[model samples]
Target: MAPTESNKRLALAIIDFLGSSLKDGTLTADDAESIEIAQSCIADTFKVDPTDEAAVKEAVGGQSLASIYSVYEKLRSKSTPQAGSASTEQSQTDKPKTGAPTAESDKFKSEGNALMSRKDYNGAIAQYTKALEIAPGNPIYLSNRAAAFSASSQHEKAAEDAELAVSVDSKYSKAWSRLGLARFDMGDYHAAKEAYEKGIEAEGNGGSDAMKRGLETSSRKIEEASRGTEPPSEELDSAPGASRGGGGMPDLSALAGMLGGGGGGGGMPDLGSMMSNPMFANMAQNLMGNPDMLNNLMGNPRLRQMAENFGQGGGMPDMSSLMSDPNIADMARNMMGGGAGGAGGAGQGGQGGQGQ
Candidate 1:
């Protein structure tokens, strides 16, 4: 018989025997060793080696006899014959027979990873689902399916799968990270933080660093939201010039000092002096002259208060001296015409001469 047909026949016989052993609870370590040896024999007969470290990982499923048979079948199918016709026939005869799973869970895992890489999350989920069906209670498969659910934005489903994976194997760091992300999406920041911390604890500081950072960020956001602050930040409270009253408005004295110096001697003029300035009076009149403009410009409460201050003649500085200064007068003349001399025409020629 050909190697493929021999492998298939052996696999059937092993599966049959394993099934019977399950009901009788007669599957022993010797039986498991026998299956492993048969798998190795099939691999060698086909000139293939079962040296893949991943292949040696936890058997496709838990330590059930049927699952072991499934693993043996998978190994035999993967071991392709490489010899000539006569040698192939001899190899097949020398190979041991065994049973295997109806499906290859590892293949499903690989296909799911490939689909995930392509961002076909739903397709990846299907592959992972198939893998879980073949090897139920597989922590790795559950974690992988959880990742697919997360990518598809099915956060609730992702959380459930991640929780199952962690329950299956508490040390599964990837599953813990996935659980954190799902919980974070569902607005369970505290739970997410705990999950991420658990992941970091299991994997040390290596593979769980990103999850740790995520926990820190989620904690900060939750704190900020609880405090009713937008544009969240950890250092917001320490910002310079920030006021109390939940960051309402700056104090009036602070605003005044910022606009100009205060109280005498090179400081801004007092309210009476400012109101007496003709230029200040002109600007004030111009602004209040238009009711529509005033309403539109002072719609904000803070701005309206500032406008009221300006109206009270307490806010403005003395501008009369500035407007009347000789340099300013000359500059104004030059601007109105081409030169001070032109603006000061013939009647004021002597006045320009006095400055010269």
Candidate 2:
């Protein structure tokens, strides 16, 4: 599939940022080869040509590196595709045999969905791709693969599959939701919101709670994004329910209490405090539901030590590492996009989180 306009723009933004950094001496001459490699990867990801300098430059036009990277961080998901190819057969657990039967294809599809539920997105995408190989042009397969791609940080590819899915069957509400979600992750909130609206219409506007919740989240994002420019920090304090300066940000002190220290009642967070404290609440919720995410959170050195400290009955230790993680902060911002944030959609937050 050809790259979406959003994907092309992303590739261009990355190239332009690297080019500017090199020119400004912030990125050294020694980094040129690595920069070229990064550019090539972006090109492959978006189906653009690395050799076409003019096209690359035009797409970037004028966008900040910080902004581009923010979108990158935003779109990243739970799994990683190999650097330059999505069709690498070695990653696949079940490769489609030549002329595989329809039943065989369906079997692979079921396995893919199972992996997706388990948060094994890489395995899921591989299985989905294999299913597609057997049953080419299957819209349901396309939409399923798209969801897996989105889960695996393959937003551009996800968008490609989603677009294909919708074109194949206009009534496929799941595909519509997948498309909207992929676009949202790529920072195309307007398009995302529109797609969700379309999806609701496609679902007859009163179908599943999943679709309704999607519309609500997308609408919330549209509202948040319409703020134009931030008024100022002073103005933020006056905004409803926003606690500025004093402690608007998350209080890391709550994590120890939330994360399995007290057996039952004593450590449980009150709804009021939990609602007031987004960062801790988010972590707590994710930890409860996603074992993989819990592993990631605990894998951080500081968090590991925090666990040790908690076991020894220490008070709140330094959570600077968890607090300072750009990925975590971005996830928090995206989730609270409910407040000043709304980067949009549940799937927009961390999994294959970039360290940068």
Tens digits of per-residue lDDT for model 1, 1-356 = 44564454444444444445745767666577676666666656654334542332222221233544454454345344556744377655554332112348779989999999999999999998887665665778889999999989999999988876775567888988999999999989988888887788778855455876977978887897778855556554343232323333323233233334235434456544554777645433433332222222223233334435555656654457434545434433433333335333412432333344
- Give the Å error, residue 54, model 2: 39
Report clash pairs, candidate 1.
11-98, 11-99, 69-100, 70-100, 70-101
Question: Model-by-model lDDT, in order?
Answer: 0.59, 0.64
Give RMSD to native, each candidate: 20.9, 26.9
Give the per-residue lDDT digits (tens) of candidate 2, residues 1-356.
Answer: 88788778777767677777888898999999998888778877887764576676456432255544543443233123456765454546664433343887899999999999999999998898788666665778888989989988999999888876665556788998999899989988787777677677778947677777777787788778777566655534443221222334322333444443434334545555664686756654543433333334433444556666655767555557566856555544544334323332222333334231
- Model number with the top TM-score: 1
Error of 1 at 55 (Å): 37
- Which candidate number has the best lDDT? 2
Judge candidate 2 at residue 221 and give its lDDT: 83
Positional deviation of residue 90's Cα in model 1 after best superposition, in angstroms: 31
Among all windows of 10 consecutive residues in model 1, the one with the lowest summed lDDT is 289-298
